[model samples]
Target: MERFYARERMGVQGSWSRHSAARVASAQALRGRDRLRAALSAMGFRLQ
Candidate 1:
């Protein structure tokens, strides 16, 4: 039973790490998009 619990904890930790990584990636993508938009605006390009 203790081993089972340990395995479960490990699985939970793995999922948490994955979630954190995904969040960071999403944030970086959003920042990149914002930067692109700003650049386009500065160039006076309209998105239509």
Candidate 2:
């Protein structure tokens, strides 16, 4: 029981959790770019 609490307090967040955060952030950035491209195309403007 004490060991569990010690690990938690040590900030051992694990690679899986860290990877999840990075994946979510990247996904959000990709979504934002796609939205921008769609909006620009809707206005008859070329995104490239």
Candidate 3:
């Protein structure tokens, strides 16, 4: 992990790490959006 950070700081390609990070972030965002939608729906809000 430290080696990865050092390479990243030095501007190495790091495509795999970047892609994995993006995927994780996207999944978390989707989960948060789903939770928010469910909360709103429970409050009687309708989504278009």
TM-score of every prediction relative to native = 0.31, 0.31, 0.34
Q: In model 3, which runs have C-alpha deviations exceeding 4 angstroms?
A: 1-33
* Candidate order by decreasing lDDT: 3, 1, 2
- Which candidate leads the pack in lDDT? 3
Error of 3 at 10 (Å): 26
Query: Where does candidate 1 stray beyond 4 Å?
Result: 1-25
Flag regions of model 2 displaced more than 4 Å.
1-33
- Scored against the true structure, residue 9 in model 3 reaches a CA lDDT of 84
What digit string (tens of lDDT, one per residue) describes model 2 on residues 1-48?
346646777544456566456645765656576477778889999756
lDDT of 3 at 30: 62
For residues 1-48, write the lDDT of model 3, one tens digit per residue: 547757678544556677556645865646576477779988999987
Instruction: List clashing residue pairs in candidate 2.
Output: none
- 1-48 in candidate 1: lDDT tens per residue? 445547777443445556556655865656576477779988999876
Clashes of 2: 0
lDDT of 1 at 14: 44
How many angstroms is residue 42 displaced in model 2 relative to the true structure, after the best TM-score fit?
0.6
Give the winner by TM-score: 2 or 3. Answer: 3
lDDT of each: 0.63, 0.62, 0.67
- Candidate 2 lDDT (Cα, whole model)? 0.62
In angstroms, the error of model 2 at 13 is: 19
lDDT of 1 at 26: 66
